[model samples]
Target: MMIALTILALCLCTCTLAGELFEPQANAQNTKASGATIKADPFQQRGLCRRWAHQSTVKNGTLYMFGGSMLLKQNNTVQEVPNTEFLQLDLAQSFQLSENTVPWQKPKINGDTIPPAFSAGAMYSGKGDFVFLYEGQTPKNLPEQPSSMWGYSLINRTWQMTDRWNHADENFPNRQSRGASVMTSDGNTGFYIGGLRAYENDTFKGWYYGPEEQFTVIDLAAGKKSKMERLPLGQKRIGPNVVYLPIGKKGSLVLVGGTGEYKVRLSAPVQNATKMDGINPDDVRLNPMSQMDTIWIYDIDAGRWFYQTAVGDKPWERKNFCMVAATSDPDSSGNKTHHIFIYGGGTDYMTPMFGMNDKPFDDMYILSLPAFRYYQVKLGDVKPDARQRMTCHVVNNKQMLVLGGHRVNSSETLKDCRWDELNLFDMNTLKWQTEYNPSDPGDSKFIPNPDVIAALGAKTQEPALGWEDEDVKCLFTGICPGEQGIEAQKKRSNARWRKWYIAVGGAGGALIMALIITMLFLRRRRKENKALRYELEQLQLYFQYQTTGEIYSSTGVNNLISDGDAFVSEKVRPMTFGERVKFVFGKKGSNNQEIPTIFDLPSEKRRETEVEKIP
Candidate 1:
C-alpha cells in the first residue's frame, strides 16, 4: 500500500511538471505578435554579457550610457572588467531595429576620458546640455576624485572638463558606491547622497564597514558647492534612493530605504600581542547595519530634515535598487506630483527566504511625497526577473526602460555578470516589452565627422567592421538569442520529444486513467492533510503568542500582539509624524495593544498603557 501511494505521488508530480513545461509556450503563442522583436543588435558585446552599475541618462532624443563593470573571458576564466567606453542609442529609432539603418552608435570619446571605471554617478543637466560624471572607484582599487567634473556635450559631440562642485569645507566628496545623484528642475543645483564606504584612515577595517552620512550639494550656476550636510545623527545609510522634489520657494531631497551598519563584535584577544595582531581578522570586527526602513526627507530650502511616515504597504529595506522620479506621474487632479518609482533590488536584510544575499525582488514600488504613501505596482506576468544594479530610466513621459543588471540565482555560484537585453515598462498601459537585439548593430562604432574632429583637435579611430579578430571574439562573446527567441527555439527543438510524449500518452491512457482515479482520492487526502498542518501551525502560533505576547504579521504591515483585549479598528486612520514615530519605535497603545497611534493625538496627550499580566 505504501509503495503504491509513493508511485501515485510521483506520477502527480510529473504531471505538474509537464503542465508547467508548456506554460511559456502557450503564453508565447498567445502574445507572439505583441512581443517586441529585434532586427539589429544594440549592445557593444553580446552573449548575455553585461556591465553593472553603469550610469545612463536621456538627452534630446538619445539615451547615453557610460562606465561600469563587465564580465569578460580572461585567459579561460571569466573576470569582471571595468568599461570606459560611451555608447548611445537613438530613442527615436530604438522602437524598431533594422540591419540597413543602424540605431545604436558610439562616438569616439577622446580627450580626458572617464577614469578607468567602476560604478559611478552620472546625470544629465538639462540647462547645461552636458552630462556630469561624479565620484566612483577606479581600476587600481582607488577612488577617482578628479579635481574638475567631466562633462560630455550633446550639441558638439565632445568631452570637456568643467568646474568641480564639492563642499567648500570638505574639499572633495567621499569615494563611494551605489550612491544616488539627482539634478534640480532648474538644473542649477545637483545633489549626491548615501554611499557605502570604508574609513579612509584605517586600512585594517573590512570593506563595507560603514556608510557615508553626509551629502554634497553642488551649485552648477555658482560653480561650487555648499558645505557637506550630515544625515540625522546615528543614522548612516548606503544605497538609499534620494530624489529632489521642488515646492513653492524651495525643495526637498527625500531619502528612501537603505542599509546601514548596526553593530560590530570583536573576537577574543590574541595572547602575546604583536604589531600584526591589530590588523588580524579575528581582532577586526564588523557587522552590517540594520536596514533603515524609515524614510527621511531633507528640506533643502529650510536646511532641516524630518521623518516621513508613509501610510500604505511599505517596501522592504533593499540595496542596489534603481529609483527615478516619474515626471509623468499624475495625481487625482491630473496634476504632476512628486512620485518616485523604485525597481529591482536585493533584500539581504530580509530573513532568509532562500538563503543569505540570495533574494532579489522583481517588484516595482511607488513613493509619493508630501503624502508619503507607498504601494507596490502589480505588473502582470510579463516582467523582468529579479535583479540589482540595473539602470532604470523614465522616458517619453510614461515609459521606463531597464538595462544591464546582475542576478545570482540560488542554484548558481555568485559572480559579477550582467543581463544583456533591455526591458521597457509602459507606465500607461502597464505592459512589459523586452527588446530583442539579434546581432551587434552594424554601426556599434563611430568616428566623428572629419570637420568636427579637426575642430576639436582630436583624431578619430576607425570602427571595427565586425567581431572578426580572435582576441575580440574572446573579449566580447557574440550576441545570444533573446529570451523570446530562445523560448521559440526551445519549443521547436522539443517538438519531436513532445510528439513522442503524446504518442506514449495515448498508449498509457489506461494507466493514466487508473492513476487519475487514484489522484482523485489522494487530492482530497492532501487537502485534508494541508488543513491539518495549517491548524497545527495556528495552534503553535497561538501558544507562542500567549507565552511571549508577540505575534508577527506576514503582510509586511504592522505586527499584532494578542492579549484578547486589542481593538483593531475596521478602518484605521492615517497616523501623524510624532504618533507614527512613537508607535513604530515600539511604544504600547493606551489599551495595552500593539496598534498604531491615532492621527489627531500628540504624544504627550496620550496616556500610557499598563502592562496586562497573562497567566
Candidate 2:
C-alpha cells in the first residue's frame, strides 16, 4: 500500500512540475553559464511541453511559468526532466497571432539562483517587478535543503538571493511545499495555501489529518511571510487554491477544491469515480482527494471563516486540477460578480470500471459569486483532451491562458490548443477559439446560468452558515449589523437549499454500489490475495536458496572447486560443451578460462613426491 501510494503521489508530483518546467529560448543572444559565455541557440532553450503541477502567474500583460516536470529528449532517449526555464508570452502578441505558434521567451538568467525543477510555490509581484518563488521539491538525487526563497526579475532578466532567502529563519519554517497553490491579486502581496509538507516514506506522506491548517500569508514587498494561526480547517488539504477577492476591508480569501481528509463525501461523483468497487491497489492514495466536497471563505479583515456551497452543474470533486478567477467589472449599478473557471484534473481510480481517468477531465465549470452558483460552459466542436496538473491564468480579462499539462493516461489523445505549448479560451464566446484577437470582446460581465437562476430565482438566497462572531457577519455583509445581502449575496439565515448538495440518486448509487463492491471484492480478493501471498513467498524462497553465483546453475561450471562443490551433488552437475560456451561467452557474458588445480596430486602421488623431502 505504501509503495502504491508512493508511486501515485510521485506521479502526481511529476505531473505538476512537468507543468511549468519548460525554459523559454532566449532570442538570439549570448548568455553566461559556468563562468563562460555561450550562444543561446546552442544552449537548446525550447518551448513548453505537456506539463502539470507548474508554478505560474500573469502580471503586466505577460504570463510567466517556471519550474515543472517536462518530457525532454537527451541523447535519443525520452526522459521526464524538470523545466527550470523561465517561459514568458506577451499577451498582446499572443492575442494577435494568426496561426499555430509557440511564442515563448526563455530569457537568459543573469544570476546563479535559478528556478527549481518542480513543486515551487510562486507568485508575480507587480510593485517589485519580480517573480518570487518560495520552497519547492528538488530532484530526489540532489541534496535536500531547508526551503528557501529566490526572486527573479522579469524586467532585468536576473535572479536574486540575499539574506532573505535563508531557510533557517524561524518565521517561514513551512518551507517544503508540494502540490500547493499560490496567488496574488494586487501583485505585491501573495497567499500560499494547502501543500503536503515534510512528506517522506517514514511518515504517512501527508495522507490524513496532518499539519495545522496551511495558510501562509506572504508579504512579498516586505520580503516576509506569516503563517496565519487564527482560522484552521478541520482537515488538511493538498493542491487547494487560494483566490483573493477584494470584498471586505482587507479582502476575503476564497478557498476552493482540493483533497480533504477523513470525510468521504461527494457532491456528485463522476461516473468514472463511481466505477471503482473498492480500493484499487494502484490508486488508494488518489481516491479520497477525487471528490469535490467543500469550499470555505476566509474574511481577512474580520479574521474568521465562513462555510459556503455552490449549486447547479457542479463539478465532481477532484484533485490536481487547476482553476482561475476573473471578476466581472462593476456594472452601471456597482454590482459585480466573480467567476472561477475550472478545468482538467484526475478522478478516482477507474481501472475496474471504464479503464482510464487518471487524468480525466476535459470539461469546464464557472462558479459565479454573489449568485454563488455553478454553470458548466458548453464547449465548441474543438476542445482539449482529458488532462490534469496544468496551471491556468485569466488573461486580457477575456481569455483563459492554459499552460503545461499532460494526459497521464496514454489511451486518451493529447490535444494541444491550436498552438502546441499553450491553450486560449474565450470567456466571452464560451469557445475554444483558434484565432487570437486583441480587439475581441472583454470579460465584462457574467453570462447568466439559467439553471442557477431557475434554482435560486434572480437573487441569491443567504447561506444558513450562522456566524459566531458579529464582526465576521459585518465583514461578510459589508455593513454594521450586516443583514442585507450585498447585492443579492447569500447571507440570509433561512436560504432554502443547503450549502453543499449530495445528489441523492448519485450519492446513493455510489454508496450502494461501493458497499456491494467492497463486500464482494473483499471476499474474492481475500482468497486470491492469500494464494498470491503464498506464491510470492515460494518465489522468494526459490530466488533466495536455489540461486547463487557460487553454484553451477547461476555461475558457469565451477571447475575451480571450493571444498563445498568438490562432491558430485546432482545440483552441481557439469554442463555440456554448448551450455558451457553459452554460459561463459554468449548469454552469460562471462570470461572463459580454464581453472588450474594446484592440489591435483592424489594421496599416493603426494606421498611419493614428499619422500624426497622427508628429512
Which regions of candidate 2 fall more than 4 Å away from where they truly are? 1-49, 73-76, 95-100, 162-175, 179-184, 198-210, 228-231, 263-287, 290-293, 331-333, 348-357, 409-419, 439-456, 461-615
Predicted structure 2: clash tally: 22
lDDT by residue (341-448, candidate 2, tens digit) is 788776644521112345467888877665566777777558876677677777666677777666755344434322244677877667786655544454334453
Candidate-wise lDDT, in order: 0.49, 0.50
By TM-score, how accurate is candidate 2?
Answer: 0.61
Model 2 per-residue lDDT at 294:
37
Error of 2 at 67 (Å): 1.6
Q: What are the TM-scores, per candidate, against the unseen true structure?
A: 0.55, 0.61
Candidate number with greatest TM-score: 2
Tens-digit lDDT string for candidate 1 (1-615): 999999999999886666544433432332232221211122435422445678777766677877665555333345455555467877765453222233457654433334334355555553566766655544333443543455776666555556653333353333455677777777778887766432222233222413233476766554344545556544455556777665423556767765554333122123334321121223322323222224565656546454433444456557678887654334354444355778877654322221224356688876654344555677878777778777877666556778667665334543533443477765544557554232244422222123322322211111111211222121112222442232343464367446655877755755655665587457545644543343334334433444454544432323333333344333322222322322221234564544443222332223244311110
The best candidate in terms of lDDT: 2
Give the lowest summed-lDDT range of ten residues in model 2: 606-615
